[model samples]
Target chain A: MAAATRPPNRPPTREIDEQTDIGEVYMRSLLRAQLRRGLTVLAVVALFLAALPLLFTVEPRLASVRILTVPLPWLLLGVTIYPLLLAASWWLVRAAERTERDFAELVERN
Target chain B: MVSTDTAAWPAVLSVILVAVATLGVGAVGLRLSRTTSDFYVASRMIGPRWNASAICGEYLSAASFLGVAGLVLTFGVDILWYPVGYTAGYLVLLALVAAPLRRSGAYTLPDFAEIRLASRTVRRLASMLVVGIGWLYLLPQFQGAGLALRTVTGAPRWVGALVVGVVVMLNVVAGGMRSVTFVQAFQFWLKLTAIAVPVLILAVAWQSDGAPDPSRPQPPTVREATTVRVPDTVRLRVDEAVPVTMRGTLDGVRVDGPVVLETGRRVVEGGSEVTLPAGSVVPHVESVRAADGATWSQPLAGAGGRDHPTYRLYSLLLALFFGTMGLPHVLVRFYTNPDGRAARRTTLVVIGLLGAFYVFTPFYGAMGRIYAPDLLLTGRTDAVVLLLPSRMLPEPWATGVSMLLVAGAFAAFLSTSSGLTVSVAGVLSQDLLRGRLRSTVRGFRLGAVLAVAVPIVLSFATLRTSLADTVGLAFAVAASTFCPLLVLGIWWRGLTKAGAVAGLVVGGSLASGAVLWTIVFGARFTDAATSVGSSPGLLGALLAQPAAWTVPTAFAVMVGVSLLTRRSVPKSVGRTMVRLHTPERLVLDRGPSRREP
Candidate 1:
């Protein structure tokens, strides 16, 4: 919208290309945004998964706890983990696209 | 031990039906796919959900379909990591690789290698690794097919492998999966329904039968007079004295009548029939560790054949979590997306699809312990998924359920085998046969033949390892090689071609060497031989699952070499990184959006 309102003689608001320094800056921002979101998701997921084996080792008796008529380990691994993964991926994808859209908006404003 | 009553016509018919449907879909795809773009990446038009389903179809090989349940049945709680790691691998892929790879516009892993490193030599090395990994992955699909067919129809083991090999070859050679997206998507649903419907029925039946906990420590017993036939000579270690009527050669002694087995190892001759009266606990093969219900339900208590359970668990998790990004067939599907964002979306959906399918596998495994415990004795634990339906239900319903599973199993083999053949053959045709052949299509057909042939031959020659374990070896190789390559290639700007090659060579050789050693010497060094000292040998555990060391070694070597060779970094590194990381919507001077082939 900002580009559309600019003066017509201003060289047609050159599109962002990899050759330009400005475009490189734009691309860097996008990559940074993406990498940040990716690492956040990775950290959350890794923490949960890494915690599982540690939990089993630290409190070996926790496995004997039956939740909804199944062993806690089976319930966590066989049942709950699937939904957790689904939700995490959903959140990450949504956040990733939002970041992309925001970057696009920034590029458009220039 | 061929069953005289080979009357599984329904299962045979279902396998045939699946083959016909796959061929029919492949033929339609062939007609529709005329251009090189269509054959390689479906013209980059696939939507997120459909592409996600196709990925799941291709990814859920015999390892996921049958092996997970089999491993869970035999190894207990620790085996749950197989499915969890499989699904979570996508999480890592989505976070690290998916969007960037799609944006890179490289059609194959070798193509990506060339694009990132700017070296033909590195490309060739990547191609070799792709073929190696593909062949290793394909081996288990063929072997699993053989085992599945033999279990279902009592057909000779070779027939199933032959049938799957021929069928997959036809599909790959036909149009090179120009329309593979639809075929694979259909197969995903077919596999899901196959597992889900039977599991639902079995669950209801289980509930009606009092829903007994499978974690009970007592050994499983036959409800009626059952006769078990051993097709191959097997040494079984009995933990308890078991009384049975025998009409076979047992440990160099022939018995035509009743005999009691003492609690030690005994060898039974091939083609021998052992009839057991009602309520006799099933004897386990000597390699399988005997576990009570309490130990079976607990994690890390009894795993990796009773050796370094904690270390093995971490190592296996490392391999599987990172390995998903490197599977050739899995990565190629990402190219079908129109943009980086769509690729990420597809991966997100794939996590959900794969997660849903894996949830039911553990149920099948847990139920198998109760109903199909005899498989432990037969050393055919992989048959648990197929046997559970028929074992639990009686008569006509059992036959119908069995046929459903047979179709699903065939779908698993066909879809995965075809996917691997296409990816492998693509690399072979492009890189290996570049100047030798006049026509790329012809070269692809030749490559398809080679791709299917080597694995089939190897499947026949090698001693059969458990399907999932064999798959895990492939994962380790993939994690050690491509995982490092992709991560460094995408993220780090200073990565040199020399670094990639060195890392690949070191990582690939070590992981594959371990796999080859296992295949060659694993049978000889059985549980009896490996557990010589008080402490189970650490070398055996390391060799068994080398991902913990090999993956980190690969990353270190890659980073180390890249730092040394920083001056040789490609001049185009900045441009390539820009292309890989930028959103497609951003106007940029990307030469052509669509690749020719």
Candidate 2:
């Protein structure tokens, strides 16, 4: 199927190869989408980490709260943080992959 | 207590088993890894799952296996940040660095530097940092081995270090990267079982003891009459006065009778013995303050004696979050992925695997506080994990549990040291001995010997610090130097050769200089300042944890220099970015292929 289309639909591929204005636009769009997703994940993590210390400072009692015989800090920092990290990473992977997939389809369609 | 000979057998056997198993796995890889590509990156055929296991196996060093629990034992909730930061580092790596780095197709960090900036000077600078960081990181692994050995078996410290050094060198020299991958993956499981099984046994024992709360709001007390031995002369701060039977010298005078210890810092001479009655408060070494249960369990309460706890915390978190991306050994594992997406998947799995391993460490710390408070008094809290099993359990069970923990710790040292040797040897052979040698594999073998030998010799002469602190210093240097160069080089097109070089120099020197200062002058400086009746203050905190300042400054220098040298940007920047960003499935016409240097 790819071989059938390659003979006639060479213009889009040529544009990317020749560094034409259209190709530059295509590359920039993909880069921007991926970068935005990356930055968003970074911002979420930074906010989450920074807020924990501030929250502890604001309400010291939170540290003492216990759930199922485990203190709040132990529950949050030791146990809960791992799943949160995995979830965030999982989210980014899906988002980044989707963005890349969309760009791949767009380039191939042209 | 059970006889010393009975206890030694299990630990001794565990160490031997781990050593033989690690070398055996490497031998399997030896037959398959005959080519240069196989030696450097497992021929780039590893799938995400196996690759993730390999990365975690290699990444979880003595610091994670033993040091985290020890830190948590010494200082309560605040120490959790170390494990959190260590794992979260991979999150940051996945989000920013992983995929693009794999896409760049660089074998070593120096190769990445040259590929991105196209400058021989930048590559050379990066090569030096890789060797420096590798050696610095390996120092603690060797020391941790000796410490663990001495604590478990009555063997002299150097025996353990020599054993680990020889075993790791042989593995690296024989199989290189391919063999190390299998060995690391196998050890990761071995380590997981080694650490996990004991925690389960201890938890059961704790339950039988009625699951006593370790977070009580008072100074920790010995549940029974405990005799504490002081190895070196240490200053102890006693909170409340108590009558204690003493042997050896105290406060420059020899007294072997009962004496009332004052409620202040008392100098306890080396080789002194003190037996305190049951339910007495455990006096801590002056360096680690004794925290009451209420304060010890509270977050941000600052149990560690260091001033400016919040500042130190932030700096430590920053260094760890950014530094994982820059580690040469860690980065080299990512290149084993087939493409960009596999790299990301592998890192995500790594985060999960590391998190699973870390969840068991805090329990060890809390259990140690309840079962073995004497460690705090002895200033050997790093041995908390190794000693906990014996303190809590009786007879045969104690010996069995102790064996598992010691073997796990030894596995941690062997796997991490071999990983470091491979990375350092890879860089050494490629750039340092590029044209000087005929065969790549032979050069790598020679590099492996040089890499492992230096740190083993240095570990003997240097005073041992906590495993976590030494590893943290290596992270800070990596975060300051390569973190900036890779972040800017991959993402930003305007980054020039001049800017990258400037950032590496500024960041590398400052961070490493701080590390050197902390290692050599830190104790003397603190002592001198305290003798004159003043704290070392802000200057000391900054030097101890420089990453909070160094990372941002590195980013700034790279950007500022690049902006100033705008015209010197590489003409191939566009092509490089395309290669880095595009999906591997997209068969774009990416022009002429660049030759390997």
DockQ top scorer: 2
Interface RMSD of each: 1.9, 1.2
RMSD of 1: 3.6
- What TM-score fits each model? 0.94, 0.95
Candidate 2 TM-score over all chains jointly:
0.95
Residues B1-597 of candidate 1 have per-residue lDDT tens digits of 112133478989999999999988888878888876787788888899989999999999999999989888878888889899999999999998999899888999999998888899999999999999999999999999998898888888888999999998888777776667778998999999998899899999999999989898775666666677787777888877888878889999988888998889888887888876677787777777767788888888874255787877888899999998999999999999999999999998999998889888999888988877777776778888988766788678888898998899999999999899989999999999888999888888899999999999988864657888888889999999999999999988889999999999999999998877776676665432112111336877787788999999999999999999999999887778768876677665554343475
**Fraction of the real A/B interface contacts present in each candidate?**
0.74, 0.68
- After superposition, candidate 2 runs with Cα above 4 Å error: A1-10, B1-6, B255-257, B525-535, B591-597
- Residue B67 of model 1: what lDDT? 90
Best by TM-score: 2
